[model samples]
Target: MTTRMNEYKQQIITDFNSRINYDNEFRYRFAKPLIELAQLKPGQRVLDVATGTGIVAIAAAKIVGDAGYVLGVDISTGMLAQAQRKVELEKLQNIELLEADADDLNFDDNSFDVIFCSAAIAYLTDVFTSLCQWYRFLNTGGIVAFSCFAETAHTASILFREKAQIYGITVPNPNATLGNPEKCQYLLQQVGFQNIKVVTQQFGFYLNDAESAWNANANSAYGYQVFQLPPDKLAQLKTEYIAEIHASSTEQGFWHDVNSLFVFARKS
Candidate 1:
């Protein structure tokens, strides 16, 4: 990996590891839907990429029964440790958790019958290349399923970038590449995936206050660039971000759009 990419990966590892405990409930809520869409079956070999805490992996393990196997890989040791605990608690012999980068995985061609990545593909350094790799990892007619956020999702993030631009800072949107159904389908098509499907679901909710929303955005991977600002500048940015939240708030509270896109395709 290039120095920049290595640094980026390290940042991602640090960020996610810190979130291992607090984010599981939220992560599982979204992952449940993706797992249902996967339609896992008995005796199938599965790969769960970036499988934080193995929510999808464990669920797959249960549904696939004793004969099936799952290999869940992630870069965060802390997250994998938690996943291991869960697997052992359930005595699931069919699932294996590994500390590995999703972008650099090595496996023989046609190694898996189904591949899953829930709410994590957008974080890959090269999403298109990663999809191509997954295509190669799957058996012919095998399915690859994953999820991402819509470009217009996360209202706080959208407003944060808009306000940050006025301060001469340009924050990157990680979800930009796989942000929409069309983008998701186009990339899978380019990678030779057939029967591509993109399902949209709204997991959006109202945050009771600006502080709650600010805290979430400030701590997220998407907010890493903004978080790196100097103390003075970051304080000013936070002030402006809170003001934007207030301006956009409704009687119900600030509506944070968690519009998620669950994408599936076959390696035909």
Candidate 2:
């Protein structure tokens, strides 16, 4: 990647980690599902791919306890640094965080007992290739779980694109393929995973009053324009974006129409 692209990616990670607070509500509502999918057990070595902010890794460490170990890997140095700091603050020696790309993981085959990827899957350059590589890293019967927004899931992507249009910035593909839950199942099976399961879920949040919801969409990878926008226009974008949401708010606040898929499979 060019330096500019690398910088942009790093900025997005920094912005996301900076703006969003992963509180109990977020954990129970979102992270918990991914953690449950991890199926972590004591004394099991696990890896968290694209572990932004180390939330899943931290949760896994608690589940695996001291007997097992959890390692989180991400591509952004800044993000990894923040995750490492959080791990240290928690004094979790059982968990390790590293800077690495999901597309090219550096580990031996059959090394991990469980592998999990959270919302980060969409950012991967090749989702299937990464799935195959991660599958190779899992032990026989090892489980791999990944979650992504379903294509039909509607939330802020539309708002983001509309805002981008106002800014004259052409954003690259969001990298998130929300299109086909079945495709996720097929990829796992093709990669030699058996007992494949694909589940879809809907979680509604009051976007009218939630700051995290707004920031998660505006500052995350979904909001590419936020990263590319010049400093002068950032405040404008933020203002207009928030206004856009409030403008549509009703008595219950704006409802976020989010649909996600959780795919689980085990290496044969």
Q: Number of the top candidate by TM-score? A: 1
149-233 per-residue lDDT for model 2 (tens digits) = 7765555556656777788875454434545667776677777888887777887566655455556666665564565678889
Taken over the whole model, the C-alpha lDDT of each candidate is 0.87, 0.75
Question: Highest lDDT among the candidates is held by which one?
Answer: 1
Clash-forming residue pairs, model 2: 151-178
Name the weakest run of 10 consecutive residues (lDDT summed) in model 1: 19-28
lDDT (10s digit) by residue, model 1, range 78-129: 8998899999999999999998989899899999999999888888888988
Off by over 4 Å in 1: 23-25
In model 2, the runs with Cα more than 4 Å from the true position are 2-8, 76-82, 163-178, 209-219, 226-244
- What TM-score goes with each of the models? 0.94, 0.80
